[model samples]
Target chain A: MAKRSTVIAITVAAAVVIVGAVGAGVAVLGSRDTGGAAGAKGDTTVTVRVWDEQVASAYEQSFQAFEDKNPDIDVKLTVVPWADYWTKLRTDVAGKSAADIFWVNNSYFADYADNGDLLDIDKTLGSDAKSAWAPSVVKQFTRNGSLWGVPQLSDAGIAVYYNKALLKDAGIDPASLENLTWSPDASADTFVPVLQKLTKDAAGHTADDADFDPASVTQYGYNAGNDLQAIYINYIGSNGGTYQDGDRFTFANPKTVEAFQYLVDLMNTYHVAPSAADTNQNGDFSRDQFIQGKMALFQSGLYNLKNVADGADFDWGVASIPAGPEGRVSVTNGIVAAGNAATEHPEATKKVLEWMGSAEGNEFVGASGAAVPAVTDAQPVYRSYWENQGVDTSKFFDVLKNGTIPAPQGANFGAAFGAYGPILEDVFAGRVPVAEGLQKAQDAANAALDG
Target chain B: MKWTRTLLVYLVLLTGAALTLAPFVLSVMTAFKTPEQFARRSSLSWPDPVTLENFGVLLTGRTEFGRAIVITVLAALLLVAGQLLFSIMAAYAFARMRFPGRDALFWVYLSTLMIPAIVLVIPLYLMMAQLGLRNTFWGLVLPFAFASPYATFLLREYFRGIPQDLVDAARLDGANALDVLVEVVVPLSRPIIATVTLITVVSQWNSFLWPRVITTGNDWRPITVATASLQSQYNGNWTLVMAATTLAVVPLLALFLVFQKQIVRSIAITGFK
Candidate 1:
């Protein structure tokens, strides 16, 4: 009787296993058939891969406009989102099954272009297309004297975005912010006093007051700690320091040391900026405090102007970066649109690039107020758009014209960027001194470049 | 003294539970928020408007959240079935059936577990490509289906624990080896089978790198791949990301809830008490 009962139980378990197996098989078959039917008609479809979904719908609308002009080409815009973009793109490229055209960034462009993963656009581009965009945009994408991508949007380095209300309360004239300058030797003499004058405690005592407590200050004078790439590169350029001297890392030089000292003074000696601990706790968006009516000035990209305009209720204005000993300088960063070498429809891909690089298309993207147009001629459209939106974008163009310096270009730009970022964070935290941090970063960057 | 011990146990359990669930709870709260809210506040708070806009947006695409759920369910079912069937059969052969060098073969199978998954990825990928299975559902499913040496070894031990008298009785009644397996060994191996099923389903469902590498389109991608892709798309907006994450976790959570009885029983049977 017990044996019979055991046999029955075994039969039931077997039946369950069989049923589950059949169900799984059917499900797999059903899904594949559905996918096949959906993807069957491949003739009329042209997929454009992008990295941001918030921007994907916007691109869809833009592509609809493109389709209206060129009715023959049916476009399908796919958003891969930024986080998965590189991983997905690399896999697709390796499999020879990538999208026809997709967005590219400066950091990853060299690797893709060198590996023949990006389609060379030099032969296809017209003279007007070649000359319309910024020279730096063209230079960055150009590999072995052949351009692999068309410039879509350009971003310049850190600009001092200050709260006008905070400046007013501190008795500092917003009009007096022009032609701002700072050198390592001269910064404490000029900027520190300005910082001290601006910083105020909750009890309303200025940092200059004898009874002032640095730890208890409610409002800071300057905002500096965030991404070291943005802050350090700006410092290095302003002090006439170069990251590399023809493939050799040169950040251990005196000019770079001067840049490092200036940053250290802002946090430790001056007591006008947020402490290293506070910045460590807060991370990159430490600038948000400035927009929220806490700090006086925040240094970040002009691209953040839109975010501030949308999020902040307070009045804010832009100013040039404080000049170092050599001269005033800003870092250049931008997005590029490139055709996948694995694309079946290279002709259609070229057409998309041509249209995107055109004056009308660049102006359309610029007018959206999401990013600055890479085209020099179309920048006025962005400036006016922002001006109408109640922020002066004149300085955005002025920085591009006078102060824009391209970010350090190297073979392993991505690897170097990743490795040195955390070390710089440690430096900013005062756990590691600036000299040691920079030396460690230089060593890492060199190793990455060698790879 | 009793109250103190109870309190200590409760505290330990609650802390463990909180550590596990906090990220998930935060993800759920963030999913309903707008991009602006997500960016400005990285805390676990409910969105002001409590919008279903991200879900609405996710639903419109070809590889929507709903589709990803279906794919993941299908993959999990396949993985569980394949693991159970193969592991039990192999375990039965090693545990009861008299064959030459059976012990040596079982040891060889167990040894393969030491070979890391990373070492096989390239060769497996190449094999799949050659087999014309790349980017297909079979491409993602087949390589992982019947390939768990640990699961087989686990079941072998459990099958070995079953009394030999029942197997001999079934064989004495003119039952074949297959019939003996079906009639005697399987019924007693329920606890281990349940444990293996749970482990197989969870691992396959949460797999990221393999599925991401094998599956080209959203059509073949499982929940983990889809969730990862969604997270990347809304990287700046933690709210929408958290929502997608919440959606991805629901099925696994539901499975755990449904199988909780069997799971607990199985764990207890495995001497984990």
Candidate 2:
């Protein structure tokens, strides 16, 4: 009986202790005002979260200037890493504890906007602010005629960046090269022949010469083995293939098939490009090969320009991508500044968005040389910055003006993109025909869309 | 012949050690390299001009690295304490005590071990939300802190191996069950406890997925989350990332170095030899 009483007493004590610990934890958490910013009136401090640390330093300086002009309001900057940014933002939104403002990517903008996770800034900004950005960028941030986010920086896919000295050493004139006239279909017929002429084996036999050993060529003509969006999108777009038709993905069209076949022919039949096995051995993202002067051509974006410019000992130049049947086409992509719908400081958040959408903010992004400013007005400023740094930024503008195409956008596009990499590997490896690989991609894309 | 055999064994052991430590050694070397050196050189080679800029960046209060360290350490501590206390008590009961249907109850508890952790996530998350524990340290620690069936079972087996005479003598000297557990059984079970503690510390310290899913912000984000973030941000800046990774893993290495003797003894006592 005494032991039973003792057991009962111990149980009660444990229960009390557990309850006390829980109560104390709750009290401590509750005492802090998580909603303090919500109740602030008039001029308030707005926090903007971004993922690009390199660009954030420039943005903070620009925001300081904005604060100088508009002393009534203050801005706070929160920088999250690119990888954790989306996951963190999603969780914060779900918990109703998100930052006042944040950055969004084109890949995620549609999902975020469609799900009503973003604030509708169209009513706040009006037509003047809408007209400041490119039409394609405007289209990306708009869902059901409501603007969800403001475009900050934009990029376009272009041809392999080449070392000027290498080209000159091979007696190739950069000025005489028709950058805009060549097409992916023309790659097998004309471009590969030219590349063959330029490529020389260590034994002093040009790739085009009789008895030239294709297997023993030390350097390749081009780097066609890269991310599909980086190389294939240009081909697909130029051949009149659409990434999405209304709500469904349609990359299985004949145009897309032709483009895929053209890319494969560059490796297998023409032998102008490196073998898939060779590229795999080097590593998937081998842009550094060109910068290090190992390869003559490297496929990438203007974002790489800064890295190459800083790292390369040799002179390099960006050129317009080769034209295709439809016209010169390059995939357009950008980052957007958005607000979390669940943020407590809605008015302050809107003010922050207004500042990010302003000319000053655009100038800051441009001058930093981190990315091309999304605003049309600030393009020249970014161009001047790159030119001052001894890079030819003219090709970027040429791509924007005459070579740009809308990047792929669709429901569950992220999921579809995840399936594309493996399918591309199969195509490159010769295990599957282009048609079979594309059909698989389309089916996977459509399935993801349904989900 | 014996010398030859020893030489072969040494060669194999050295090869295994090199294979195991290669990635870690590479990370340490890369962490000290400048971005230019990293981009130009092979990932295996030492830096031409080594620098601590990466460590400086990580240790700065402006970045999430410092906060991540504090969160990881605190979570590990809470997890270790909770797991040990509950597991010891429950294990003691299963090994020493008699009750109606005790074997049946113990079996039912052990059966939970078969259920995968992923399958329990959604239901457990819902429970946490319902209890208003989401985004809290308690939320990160509590669900996982309880006596795991595997852990409890292991401890129970170890406890059962303890000589019952010591417990019986304490009980005869007018000591209660709790007293016997604290005074006699616990002292005899030190080696097993150390083994369990080491296992718990390592597992809890390296836990990524659950803490990642539970925590909402940098306020509770752990070292793994920080490491992942660093990897993504500096995808091109491998030098900085390798430095951060090396720093993040050093504590575990240090813990192993300090407690290796105790750990080996515990392993022997637990019949894991």
Highest DockQ model number: 2
- Scored against the native two-chain complex, candidate 1 gets a DockQ of 0.30
**lDDT of prediction 2:** 0.73
**Estimated TM-score per prediction?**
0.85, 0.87
Can you give the lDDT of residue A280 in candidate 1?
A: 57
The residue pairs found clashing in candidate 2 are: none
Question: Best candidate, TM-score-wise?
Answer: 2
Q: lDDT of each prediction vs. the true structure?
A: 0.73, 0.73
Candidate 2 global TM-score = 0.87
What does each candidate score in C-alpha RMSD?
4.4, 4.8
How high is the TM-score of chain A in each model?
Answer: 0.86, 0.84
Question: Model 2, range A210-322, lDDT digits (tens) per residue?
Answer: 87777876656677764555677777887777666765777688888888788788777666677777664344335666655656666667777777777777877766666
TM-score for candidate 1, residues paired by index: 0.85
Candidate by candidate, in order, the iRMS in Å equals: 4.8, 6.1
- In angstroms, the error of model 2 at B143 is 2.4
